[model samples]
Target: MANRFLAGYHAAFNQYGIWLSVPGVDVTASGPAANFLLRPDFKCEQIIISGRVAVAAGFNVDVMLPITVPTKRPYVQFGVAQSGVGQYPHDLSMIGTTAQIECIGGCLFRSDRLTFSNSNASGFTFYYDYLVFQRGIN
Candidate 1:
């Protein structure tokens, strides 16, 4: 389950009521934002990722694929990091998508490094529930 409630990610909006009317005429704009249900695809961004995973048992591993982030002002990539044994959850903030891509499966191959860069850079901003994978992960 996502942690939107815990993070208070609920929409923030403004409400306005128009004045001046004959008697019972009133109009309001932009009411309370509605809460939405998260979809399965939302759990893990349906990004096309391929990469190799190695196990000590000498078992055949698979590379899901690769995801290349387009370097823009804020370059972000989201996807499920497959693990052999367990499932990983996604951040609530990540669910509220700010970008839409029609071709979700695997993106057309591109260079590894991103090209989008901005000037007067102060710092980078990332929104997500950051957690360490593990200690043995090298």
Candidate 2:
């Protein structure tokens, strides 16, 4: 498929490009692998994967991706979202939750997965929304 550029000022000034899946095509996961296979013609220099997961305290959560990244180390950004008394997104001044990518002693990333862990032992479940950006995809 051809790459489509954004219209208007951004396309003219920045040349921002976007890719869309072809119509009538199925990219869903199949078989034992359970990974969504990209179209053979799909190509891009960068891809962003975003999702939300609930992580239990003192436990690790692994998220599997549909694409195999070019490098084992990709840029990751994440944040915890909670709603309750004295918690974030509800109480603005509270520092109630903390999380981190387990890179030091845990699996941070593989070619197709990302692992996240938190140090909070309050027995509270944290809902984390993360974005994984990988460049050099072709």
Residue-level lDDT tens digits of model 1 in 1-138: 222321111122221111121222221211222332322112322222222222222122222223222331112243321123222333343344565322112112233322121121222222111121101111
For model 1, how many clashes? Answer: 9
TM-score for each of the candidates: 0.16, 0.45
What lDDT would candidate 2 get against the real structure? 0.48
Clashing pairs in 1: 49-64, 49-65, 50-64, 50-65, 50-66, 51-63, 51-64, 51-65, 71-116
| Residue-pair clashes per candidate | 9, 0
lDDT of each: 0.24, 0.48
RMSD (CA, Å), each prediction: 19.5, 12.1
Candidate 2 lDDT over residue span 10-88, tens digit each? 2222222233333433223111212223322234434457767776777889999666554344567666644333332
